[model samples]
Target chain A: MTRPGRDEDPDRLYTVTGGRSRSTTGAETFDLVTLVVSESAPVRGMQSEHAAILRICRFPTAVVELAADLGLPVSVVRILLGDLLAQGKITARHPRRAQTADALPDPDILKQVLVGLRNI
Target chain B: MTSPEISPPPAAGTGRPAAGTAQPVTGTTRPATTGGGTATGTALALLVSVVVASVATLAAVQAGDESARTAIAWGAGAAGAVLCAAVTVAAHARLTNRSLRAALAAGNARAAEREAADNHFADATVPTVVERLRNGGSAETALAEAPPVASEAQRRVLVTLAREVHKGENMRAAAMSACANAAGRVQALATSMAADLREMEHRHADEDVLADLLQLDHRNAQMGRIADSIAVLTGARSGRRWAKPIVMESILRGAMGRIGGYQRVRLHSTSEVAVAGHAAEGVMHLLAELMDNAANFSPPTSEVHVYVEEVAAGVVITVEDGGLVMGEVALRRAEQAVLGEHGDLTALSGTRLGLAVVGRLARKHGLSVSFRPSAHGGTGVLVRIPRELITEARHEERAPAPPPAAGPAPSSPRAPLGAAPGTPPPAAERTRPAADHSRPDTGPPRQAEPVGTAQHDAQGHEQAESGGYATAAPPPQQFGESGLPKRRRGQTLAAVARASATPSRTADSPHGSRSGADGRADDDRAADGRAPAASPKKRPSGARFGDFRRAVQGAGDPEETGQTPLPSASSPTRSSSLSEDDTE
Candidate 1:
């Protein structure tokens, strides 16, 4: 898929990934919610995107977040992450999806907030 | 010097004979030859005349009486005496002429000797002057470096040469300044065009339009190169300047970005040295020309490889292409072109012009460019930059930057210089990540910031950053790691915080700040390939470009399903102004 903002030739991307189009790790392995964390800091002469990934992943980060953070297409991010993964530079784990209702505040807390608003 | 050991001490400054010149020196020896010595020499002439007259009188005696003969002899003697006096004067003149000629010859020889000495002085002095001027060294320093001369004539000659050299320098400077003023404008226009294209890329959400903008961007970059080349040939500085040293890798990437076939060119760098700001542009341009040549001449399927090595002297860049091997004569001609001897643009065809451009740049910066038969059977061109032009990269500068980015030095004179063409980036531009707006091609911005480790940076970034740094900073740090692609270290806290907030905000509040059917409407608008709504609720308010980045980075590229709009050419006045520059 074509990246949205960028229009550079695939030639640059080809060189970046050493002409690899598929991720070494199964592409399906890195789902949107998958969480990944860097095993180390960025070293000198590391690919800027890779370094950016390591620096940003000082904390666990989701695959989608990594893609957005690096400003790369998810596919490109997967390939780079695959490279890192193969080299043991980072670890990825699938996170179970939490329910949307659980994400909202408790109903009791919501009722107290409504009563407080009425008093004001 | 083969100096005629004759009295030459006084001839130093004048380079002419001192003593005899004090005489009433005439071009011919006859006048100056005449002196008091002729009188005594007349006796021999008088004797010969008397002998001839006696013979004449003897002949007269045979034809007349004794009294007549005696009178004839006396008369003949008197006549002989007068004849002898005239002959003596003529003889004296000749002798004097001979002596003067000898003196003149001696003088000419002595002058030649002084010239040899003057040449000796020039051999030592001219290089010092040239080196000084080329390095932006002071005239006083160059003069101070001139070795002491032995004679007044030497000193005088030196002064005269200095005056002429300075005059030539002034003429060159005047011409360069004039070209610089004009080319600098064109250069600025091209640069700003790049900015405008970027801005449009921000506003437009259409894939087709963005692609078109990229092509326009490419063309603008090429035009900028031509303008910059003209400026360099005219002896003006390159279009852009960096306040701080530029990493060798970044400089290569910057050069690569200028060419149309940049993607086919791959960079392999082992050097970490940075070039001093003054020579950085020259180096970059030189590489661009070489890379362009490599890409242009080689087979379409072939790749151009660049290898950079740091040597004891400085940094060396090798551009090797896998094209057909060049003919010996063709190689020589190409090499000659690289010398840039034919300064007039029309003297060269387009191909030679490219090599000439690179040669001129290399010469100006004191970098050496050499051509060799490549291992791949194509051409291998190596450029060696001198130590003087090279500097150590700052610790932070190791991050790959596409365009030379300013380091810790805040004075970054280039910001204004790059924007100073006519209109600076709009006021708001100054407030954004100055670099983002200042130079859109900054590669290292999305740095794998060695946030906490050194070797980790090296071990992790080596392959990527080396070649990566060599790549133009294509990925904007819009939603970059830590959200602050430009900030690092202690400030990374804020960057990470901002970066974290950015992703969550965009993910949780998809479709911008609007909700319900309106959100769907905004989504429909984006899908329609129309400009996104500019509502105040756009959280990343001024970060419209950022929104475009995420959307363009494929964040929302396809998420806007089937919305379509009537594409309209509605943008800025700058587009027209930009087209005007292209016509020129």
Candidate 2:
């Protein structure tokens, strides 16, 4: 799915990835629901697409969102993120705690945060 | 699994009655184990049914018979209750075993699915890893094998995986083909552009503009060569052709024009043989490659000589150089390069594609090329232009015919065809100095221009009359063999100056003639440029009558007997005695 564009030869893809479809971990470490963040700037000789991915992932972002922003398929994006994660170039975690209703900050704590914000 | 779903709710009804009788046992065991509760409840239900049946039988016997029938009925009820409990327990154990086996099977299926997913990833991931390992100097690492499958479902997954791999292979092949197709299209576009530029070059007339156009034309030819190489690589036939045969001499000149250091190339023994129109470009390419190699390998100061001769089978072109002697291996390589058999891609890749392209063109045209050490101690390449590609050069016949009209005017009845050779030496020698002043190589640059234009017109006429044969420019021949008195050379030089002054008209007819009262007015006009003061009788500049007279005079004089410069210039003599008096 959208591995490369018309001018960029698919053969170049084979050379870039060495014909491997995913990261060294074998399975995708992150999925559409998983959030990812860049750990560092990309290393040299990194592919343009990979560098673009790093630039977009400064903040924690869902895998599906990254794929959408990069104009690549979800599966291909997952593979790229998996490579970065394996290399310690990025980190990923499930945003499961954010889904829990009770984990929201208390009103009194929010009011204090608001006061702190006004002071700043 | 469906059977359990459909019957479990209804079966719970039966469990209720047993639940009451086995209440304590069921309640205690239900929290501990499902198997225990179902077994105990089943037993109690069977016991209730047996007791109810036995009690009814006893009541009926008491009412009908008496105390003896009552004891037998009670004993029968107890035995039936025992049998019912054992059967219930056995059935419950069997149902539990089946449910456990089904659960194990489902677990196994899930594990297999997970393994298959892992295998698919491994199939994609392993090759790159192995390739990396190999690239990293661990060449022994074999490719990762496919993960083993466990069930029919996994086998189906494997089949799908295989199809995907093939689809990827086909996609790569299609991409490669598309790249090749794009290359071919670019080559075609470049070739057409080159042709257009050539047409533009011919239309331009200004000298400086034409020079620039000629340079552009050379670049376009270079581009065409590159396109031809690409086209040949992509399996397309060469696109250049000639409508009519071109002589080997002009072919050599065309090839020479494309190369630098053309001034040092000396062509010798070129025959009046023309190559077939279709094979002209192939011959041009072959000669250019060989000549370029000669120029490059030889010292810059030295010359490269080419000889073209027609043999029994075909035309043989020998290219000789004066340079370092080639080693045995290099000679073999040069030989192989021209024959098109050097299959090593690396050797044939870059600028060295010159000889490889030559080989390709040669093979396409059915020509043979060989290399050997020259007599000059450098490499010599001989290309045999085969009989099929060779034709009779048309310009030779035309060159001699213009001089025929003078033959009848100067001598006997059969003079035009035969005896004009007996009397025309003085006149032929007279025209020699004129041919010299008009020659582009020896004459001043400004004088060369008009002579060139005259030659161009003459060539146009030859092309028209001969149905489009490209002729070589006339080479200057020395007149020493005519044995004319050297004291009269000054007078001949003056006559030459007069004749060369009107180059275009003199070029029209190489032999000027005087034949009045004959209705051949065209011949008279062609001969008008000859000076009336130099000769009382006018003659065509191309007349072979002078050459024929030199031939007869040489036959009559013994000293000059075997000394005709060209065989066509002389005839066999009868007595050879008149030459002795001339020598004295």
Candidate 3:
């Protein structure tokens, strides 16, 4: 484990998220598997954690990995991600629809498509 | 609710003390931080080379043996330089085996390049180059100073000396750089792991698991310090820089947390002091290395006592180990190590590496760390930090009030410590006379007014009331004295006053002694209640000191010194704590 590196103490976690532990319930929410792609490069004088997040998300990335890369808790990273999404600095992609191979396709839709092809 | 890592620390805060000192102060004109006015090895080497070279030149010219003259000068200059610095080189074998062998081989090579060389040279050049190498001067520069010559025996002699010194310096430099780099990488991974542990520590609810994680965290902190030693020894600045000043107590505790035997370390006392943020890391690491040495050397049963006192020179921290005392020779060896004398690799390999680390750090911050025999029969280390590196700790947290009075401006960080009586709080700004009368003039004016001007004070209070409730602040001091026990509360309050509330009124009432006592008791309570929480700016630098003196000095009767605002103000001599002479 690293020794306490309090020297890099930033503006502090409270001020970083405006005391909001969770993302606001609006557009662009984040989940563990949600993907984030940075639209802009990190610039000088940005909140260090935010800059780190921007630099890490060079390609579409997962919220969990971002938390690991930034060395911050998922909750903190979610709040930071929410902020970035709101600022349009990054885009988040939702998780894919869940399904299993055992689940069958609707037979009626398949038959209708077959008849339409025959008619053509 | 206490985490084991957090419990023993004096004040609350995250402890991430880094290792390493700031880069060596840039110029040579200034005395090296290693301390002392005597010339350094580098300077003395130059002086000796010039003197020895000139004497050798004069002797050779008298004999009229031109060829022998240069050789004699080269030999004397080289021998003189080494012998001069050798006076301080405690361990003669400090020069690596590789360098010694190279020098011996160069001597044999020089013997072959005898009479064929006839070129005249600057009398001092060859000897100067030899002196440079022996003093740990860079090899490349030494070679450039006096180049090698195959036919000229004197030049060959100078060339060999330069090459030998280079071999030793280059080896040490390469090793230190590599060690620092490796330690840095390890600390980075450890930092990442520590962050993860912090996260796990929060998510886990099982008491047993949490305890396990705490152990891992402490062990990890110890490892971080070990890595830090490597970087510090290499003379590199590593780790976090604090932007806000950290109180002295917290810095001590942070150092304790980094060592293995922290539990046995007793931080007995710390007066009000704060290290400016930039120098905080170096000071913390320096302390950690010392504490670790103390705790490790002392018996497990005995406690290591640490006392921090504010003195004129700066803050003095005394770390005493209650174990066997260090002998005179050992003490001198350690003193030299910290001062950064001797040679580059004197004790880098053995157990003395810790001392080397301390020396490097002490020099980096210009802190003077000296050792003296302690009363407990163990070694006592005194670390004196210069005043320039400290900022007054803002102990005025509860005093959130905005600046109510106009005279004491906001936050003068270094407000001429002990704002001695010469700059007493302005009389017009205090309006003490007015506040005395305004005390709900309905309260029967409890003060036994020596001057019988209670009515006048009431008028001033009435006028001040219209401007703001400003006059309300002074009444508590007037009314609170008789109602409370004075001594215990008085001293305690004086400590909390942050050196700002001692008005000159304490120094000169007709009842000089009595009013001083009563007014101070009331002032302590009044000041505590009125401390502005929102405006945690600086207070009068010596106000609290003035209060300490007032409380300690004239403990007079409340009735005898009855509050009349003791209109005469600004006598710094009333309480002597106001004088902070920069005495080291």
Candidate 4:
């Protein structure tokens, strides 16, 4: 479908994916909210983006959040992460599903916050 | 699963079921269309079409002929047609299979190109992304190692990121060093220019030329100050030094002399104590900057009043201006900086660094600075100089009032007396030998009592007091000894008037005058008896301006030989009011 003679070629999403739409790390798929962290210190001669990921992921950071921080698309972040994960440099885990009922603040904690605010 | 904050089991079991369906679609769709299944399906469809065509041909042939011969001929034709159709189907299958193989090869090549392009894009975008990441934390240095990742592209990106960061750091350091070097060169050039101007002031005995020279000298001081401030901000030392302790009044006047708006500053009370030689330079720079700021920010017609008070622990110099009042935020920021809280350089207003420079100098010298709203509807800055830098040198003599003479030290007291009659007839005679050389710029010449007019040596003290510092010993004072012909004396007097009019050659002036005028040397040594020996690198300009003032004072007397008893009468008061108040 690509026009060969056109001067301007719009970048396709598959270009970032290396024309393979799926992760190569077996059947495991990367979720948007999966958290990732560097498992070891960054080594020399790695791609700058990889080193940057290692630098930013010293603490646990979500896949979507990493994409936002790196200013890359989510799909690109997923691919880079899959590469990092395969090498054992970074580790990823799925985010916990939301449980609205359990996540509500305790009444006692709310009372304490109210007291703190009034004191201020 | 590893992180304590996030629960992982629910996401693993229930999240994004659509993501699962995507994997099977990719798994089944490609092979179903392009693999052996497509080949088998195509073969089966061809077979069915061939069978239907053969049956139709046989049925038509059977219906067409009843005779044995006709049936045999029709059967033979039908069989030929079936063979033709079977051959066509086989050829089509072969061509389809060959084209499919070529398409598959082309797809593999395209995938390789897309992967290469992906790597290229990644390489180009990594540096900007890495820079943003580095700015997020100061602990980036701790991230000295890159993790092990299998992807070669990812590894290269990390390496480029680290290199870019190192390059940026190196550039910043180089810029800072270059700025420091430029500031130092400017300071040196200003100092040398000031010295040369002083030397010129020494040779000229005309009042108007000397006054213009003094003003130029002041401008040079201001330039040196600006350079010094920039150098200090860049973390270089302020290299100015003084040879001996100087009176607080001398320091104040020296600072005042450097500013353009000196006439608008009104001095109130000041301390009698002297500043130690080591801290003298910083004190002078600091006061000059504060007063300069005060004068610059205020309305032209409004006066800035300065008050100094000696407290139990130290001395306080207060400068109050009548400028537009500062906003609360700006005032608070200024006060924080003055009181040792450094604001971000980028946060400071682009127009002014005066406060920042003042704060840096104050912090370096252990001085406390503060800013407050003034009664004058502007701002007041109070700078407190600690007691350590203040020394009690009230009666110390031998510290010449201000080291004024920059010429070759007069080897002995009699040298000037011996040299006066021969030394080119005192500069005033050579240029403008007429009686009415009163400069148009200086308005009317005010005649007053001429002190010690009989000998150049006798008038050294008056010259020091009147001319600031430079005119004390050289040309005019030397010319006073000879009662040359009336015209020659008039020339000498004009030269002397010029010398007297030059002002404020304080502590930083060259000590070269000490050896030339025995009378002034003795007076200086007696004035600050405990003062240390002068530095040899004294700025020559201070001495020349002092000498120029004495020449001016000397010229005034001869021009109005019969009119007034006032000699050293006009300019001396303004200068001595500074020195005299210190002694009191």
Candidate with top lDDT is 1
State the lDDT of candidate 3 residue by residue for B1-584, as single tens digits: 11222222311111111001111222233223321112233234434544554465556556656677677766655555454444323221222222334444555565444433433233456566767776667767777766445445666666676787678767877787888789888777666666566546434424345456656766776787777777776665665566557667557766776788877777765354678888887888888899998988888998888888888999899999988799999899779778876546645677767778888878888999999888877889999989988887543311321222211111111111121111112323233422432233212222433332232222222212211112223212322456542321212333123112323343355654554443443333222222222012112211221222223222334342213112111121211121111010
Q: Write candidate 4's Cα lDDT for B1-584 as tens digits.
A: 12111222222222223223233433445433443443444445445644565566666667665666476646655564455445444544454455456555766786787687666546554544555444542224413433343367665766666666666656665676687789988877876666555345434433345456656766776788788877877777775565556666556766666676766777664355778777777887788888998999999999988888999878999999999787888789888766655433554565677777788888889988888888999999888899999986533121332232111111001011111211122334323311122212112221211232223322432333222222223322333346441223323554455444422222223422322232232222221221121112111211221233343333332233111111121122222332333233
Which segments of candidate 2 are over 4 A away from where they belong?
A1-120, B1-211, B340-347, B394-401, B404-584
lDDT of 2 by residue, B411-485 (tens): 111111111121222434323433442232222322323333343323222221221111122211223456432
Estimate the overall C-alpha local distance difference test score of candidate 1. 0.52
TM-scores for all predictions: 0.47, 0.34, 0.40, 0.39
State how far residue B243 of model 4 sits from its true place (Å).
Answer: 3.4
Every candidate's DockQ is 0.05, 0.00, 0.03, 0.00
Quantify all predictions' global Cα lDDT against the true fold: 0.52, 0.47, 0.50, 0.50
True contacts reproduced, candidate 3: 0.06
* lDDT for B404 (candidate 4): 21
Give candidate 4 regions above 4 Å deviation. Answer: A1-120, B1-162, B337-345, B348-350, B394-584
Judged by TM-score relative to the true structure, which candidate is superior, 2 or 3?
3
Interface RMSD of each: 14.8, 41.4, 26.1, 39.6
Error of 4 at B475 (Å): 26
Of the candidates numbered 2 and 4, which has the greater TM-score value?
4
Report lDDT (Cα) of residue B398, candidate 4.
18
On residues B1-584, what C-alpha lDDT tens digit does candidate 1 reach at each position?
Answer: 11122112212222122223525443445333323223223334435654665566567667777778777766665565455545544554454455557667766887888788778777876666656654544455555667787688766765666556666666667776887789878987886676565445434434345456656766777788888887877766677766567766567776877787877888887465778877777788888899999999899889999998888988788999999788888888778888756565556665456887888887788888888889977999989999999888654433433222222111111112111111112323222333343222212322322221121111112212121221222222334466444433222344333433433433454532322223222222222222233221111121222222223222222323111110111111222232223224
For model 3, the interface Cα RMSD in angstroms equals: 26.1
* DockQ score for model 3: 0.03
